[model samples]
Target: MRTTYLTIAGRIRQELTEITQVVERVQQIWQLYTSTQPRGNEFLVDATALNLHSFYAGIERLLEVIADRIDREKPMGSAWHRELLQQMTADIPGVRPAVLSPETRTRLDRYRGFRHVVRNVYSFSLDVEQIVPLVRHLHAVDAQIQRELSQFADWLEQAAGAE
Candidate 1:
């Protein structure tokens, strides 16, 4: 049981790290895309927009993993990412629910929409308008996750110290 708990904790840490890096990259790209006035070839901007969507997809995957691990002892389960989030909110008091605070929920919603677009290979192009909002949402989610993780880490440390 201890080993299982340790493993899950390690995975949560890993996912948190990945999410942070992705959020940072998304912010950097957003800065680059928004700094200058619209000019030059449209294709380059279009490609960058797609890349931004891809980064959100990556964030979604990480969140899904973290949520799943929180709910189940093992990670090998059905794709219950959404269900897991709901269960987490309903089941775990304070700790896990902190992971899905309002800000995080907004980011997840935006990511869900972007994921749908990417999965369907939708032709709709993303402009600075969409990217800016998404980046802001992503940053908010990142902050929430960081705060939650810190709390979680503290909890783990206290538990370990007790043991």
Candidate 2:
């Protein structure tokens, strides 16, 4: 049976798959970035930074889809990225529970800043120091998002079943 929860959850699930792909690709890039000797491996680092940028981009895309589809609202203005993340932590009165926690919000906020830097600067200009923590901690955010979304999906499935 078709239901609102199924439709919403279906799309979010597809997004999680896309994020998994980004995670795989980012992992490969990180391996290349780390294994190569730092002395002569500008290319590897640059590749990693680009992929890191993509990682955040993919997550933002997923959030945008969820915001538009389930929340029925798209943030407006120059700071929409921040607002969208904020929205995820909010409980919309008649809509749905917050999709993620405030702690996740704090972590994702860093990437939001990183994403901005990646966009505004050249890849070669990326600082290895800056990218290091993001790479190191990527899996934590990935897991957190996966766990949160999975629970949401279960809730959605139950809602669908009830309907």
Candidate 3:
């Protein structure tokens, strides 16, 4: 139905908006990380970790929207994050095509693991070393997500127009 495609297109737009917020937050975090004088201070490190956590949180939120609207599944398990990512890359039965490539999923797993760490620990305890790599790669992941979502948006528009 065209309504289904329209729904997906609408939700994708929402996710893209959320992605913008996520990128803004991540850029802010990266700025804090870079702009700190003599670096590795307590406040900067703690705030950056929390902000980095938000980056992954944003990624998950968008994926949840896609799953709920398009895949019609959200996976239930102790490893639901992994399942959710896999779901995004899977072709749902006559529902919709995969929303992410395996490569993007792999890149996203890094954020997923960081998100898990952020959840279980106190922010002050976050290691600067571990956080550095994710921060460094943040733009790459964000760009990939943007490119992929743009393609999906085009697909949704085409699907909607087919009615």
Tens digits of per-residue lDDT, candidate 1, 1-163, equal: 3454455556657767776776676666656656657654454455555655665555456455545555443233554445444443343553343445554655566666665555565444544465556666666666776676556555554544555
Error of 1 at 20 (Å): 2.1
Which runs of model 3 end up more than 4 angstroms from their true locations?
none
Best-to-worst order by TM-score is 2, 3, 1
List TM-scores for all candidates, in order. 0.67, 0.89, 0.86
Q: What is the lDDT of residue 158 in candidate 3?
A: 91
Model 1 regions lying over 4 Å from their true place: 40-59, 66-70, 73-81, 93-99, 122-124, 156-163
Q: Which stretches of candidate 2 lie over 4 Å from their true place?
A: 1-4
Instruction: Report the C-alpha lDDT of model 2 over 1-163, residue by residue, as the tens digit.
Output: 3376788677778878888787788788778767767566887777777777777787788778778877889899999999999998998876778888999988888888988998899878888898889888989998998888877777778867876
Q: Which residue pairs in candidate 2 collide?
A: none
Worst 10 residues of 3 by lDDT: 39-48
lDDT of 3 by residue, 26-98 (tens): 6786687688787766776777677777777777887887777777678887999999998888877667777
Clashing pairs in 3: none
RMSD of each: 4.2, 2.0, 2.0
